[model samples]
Target: MPPTPPSTPARDEARIRDRGDACPGALRLHAADDGGLARLRLPAGRLTAHQVEALAVAAETLGDGRISLTSRGNAELRGLAEECGAELAALLAEAGLLPSPTHERVRNIVASPAAGLDGLGGPEVQLWARELDALLCAEPWAAALSGRFLFVLDDGRADVAGLGGDVTLVAVRPGAGQEPAARQESAAGQDPTAGRLHVGGRAWLVAGADAPRAALAAAGAFLDAARAAGNGAWRVRELPEGSTPDVAGALDRAGIAAEPVPPAESLLVHAPPLAPGPLGTASFHVLAPLGRLTAAQLRALLPAEEVRLTPWRGAVVVGAAPGHQDHARLAALDSHGLITRPDSPWAGVSACTGRPGCAKSRADVRADAAPGSARGLPVHYSGCERRCGHPHGTWVDVVATADGAYLVDGAPTPRTALPDAVTTARTGAIARAATPSTPAETTR
Candidate 1:
């Protein structure tokens, strides 16, 4: 591995913030350096084609004519006209993207993009995400959750398990010769006990064969702990180290048995991050180059009714009609310059929109970022020390220093030597996995 970056911002520590979560939502817009920015949470990053077209229209008419894909699998509209709030809200509501204004921000849920489509987690997990989302919106007390509070519905893959979800539900396989059930716990002929529910770094078997309910129970437990802490904590990890809620007890209270599924040790496996490329037979997944999608490009994905966004700046084109091969659509997307191959030079490359868009940025990192090979871990180019939007796991860090040189993992190097230096670091003969810090599953 490229000599482990000497300085990677702490990933496991609970973020201590004195200020409330000011994360913008569809109704609430944050005045960004570029313009008014609106973030619309997509429960599990699921979006219908109609919704996509609506967002495209909104971007074209009310904002920058471009939609930015956030690292959280949500959609962001930048350069919004200052007076576009009423019109924007109306548009989003009509699209059914804004169901609960009160709980819009709290609907920060992300699930495996290839779950049901690719059989990685099956259709039940994505369904659980939707069900849990409805549950969250229906509960008045859930409004107390900070906009930053996250729920990860992973399909037993490590892809999102470590993304720092305060509450996560990981899919578990059923016992051999056993089928899985939907809402009941371990019923005969049912799927694996709706997987397992994990909170912070600890995990427990879920009660209720219904994985969705178990997932919701985990959220309620976090809510209980957050309220008990009374520190306005927005995440389970932030509720003082020893205070992770009794998830088992929470299930018991909810009338679901708190079955012990597996220990934290067993659930700590990290799946290698999924790269941009074709997924499954018909699903075509692509990354947004640098997580930015233009209005036209966003609409190009409408060959189907819906697509699934991923936390990794990628999206899976799903909902295609059966037997409808996406060869032409994939080719068209490729023609539009979207990354759709795993071996492409852009596989693990990313950069922040520096220069004009962000006044805090000192350089145009995107323009300066060279085509990257997939030999090393993911590398991100940041304009300044803030290093906004860096990867979560073992990856390379390249931050632009004021002197025109880039700081490659804390060591200052000329921009000219960056490519070789990064390559060597990534292609190092010895590759090792990062062990879980606390058996606590998050690097979020």
Candidate 2:
């Protein structure tokens, strides 16, 4: 059986300060071992169709013509030649992508993918997401946050909210008794928007006027305290003891109402939205075998549709043709190992770029963990022992130990005896080793 999930520790109060976050942007790409890397932050994981075309164009014209989806719901372009940096930056800026030079990298925000499209008559979670993004963009202090820091705006459904974001805004469904008060002062005359706001597992019931604004203010408070502390922490949960104020206190400073809801039965799972029905279009998800894309593939992608970069180390190609992806198109994608349906062995498998891509990698794990070649739940490929992009919630963990590769969930099983460790991890069954001669695992 899988190990019992680890319990979340209480928030620490220790203050942390940082020189600044080193997150990269399209304008300012980072030179990695493999090549130049650029990260494009996707606030709320939402994009317009035109912007999608621009990204494909940018990837082809500037970098290696391949696009990568990051674990932060952002996009990356890799293997760029040094000569193209300035031209690439200028092209991205012209596309309305690189907004603020100083603030480009720190604009890390994630919102539920189903926010606006969900028809639960819920509050406009998308509205709150956009409003918060605007607030972050306008604030100078927010730039102090590390590139890894994250903000999640979840519609009470808790989808992206469960991904362990530093800041979260969850919607509350109001009771019938409050309907009269809700309508008279509601932002969009909606019932879903009528409930209290919660932060850091604490609740705040604000007057309708202060609800949204206070949430932004609350984020500011967290940032302020984090900067005051000396530690170089990126998230609120990482603050030193007594550094982070209680959620109620933060709201008190912001003048927002406070309340507490009963504990939830299950954390939200971000399964891709099912294909759209006859009347409307539905968003869809797709995975990049190694978060690497070719220039030709970029050009071939439909430019009119916006794409979502998932924190799951995959990209969701939204606005797929309704009913189902065209059969021939599906075949073409399959030829490239980009599976659209759920049953494909590639469904739950994800790996990071090892070997030539990352200096700390122990092996070229991607080449060994090719899609369909392996099978398993939440399988992750790591260069060294540090598992960087492993899924946060629940899934099997495959790590590269000094002795050999190991499967981590409860116990660590050495790869020396397994027939094919890679295939076993991917498919969830034991098999013979596919290749001989194991790569030596090293630690720094």
**What TM-score, over all chains together, does every model reach?**
0.88, 0.77
Residues 284-388 of candidate 2 have per-residue lDDT tens digits of 455566555565554444542655555654445555555565444555655665645665555556666677877877666766564434334456566665565
Off by over 4 Å in 2: 1-19, 118-123, 175-191, 194-198, 205-212, 246-282, 298-305, 316-319, 322-336, 370-376, 402-444
lDDT of each: 0.72, 0.57
RMSD of every prediction: 4.2, 6.5
Worst 10 residues of 2 by lDDT: 435-444
Candidate 1 achieves a global lDDT of: 0.72
lDDT of 1 by residue, 1-444 (tens): 334432422434454556777768889987767788898999878888898889999999999898777667888888887898999999999999999999998999988778866655566667878889888899898887888788887776668787767777777665422223332244313444356677766666553255677677777888787667665666665677556777878777777655564452435556877776566666778888877888888888877757887788877888553444666677788898888777876777777667767777778887778654566677777787656666667666778888888876667778888877677655554353332222111011
Q: How high is the lDDT of residue 58 in model 1?
A: 96
Q: How far is 341's C-alpha from truth in model 2 (Å)?
A: 0.8
**Stretches of candidate 1 exceeding 4 Å from the true structure:** 1-16, 176-193, 207-209, 262-266, 321-324, 429-444
Best by TM-score, which number?
A: 1
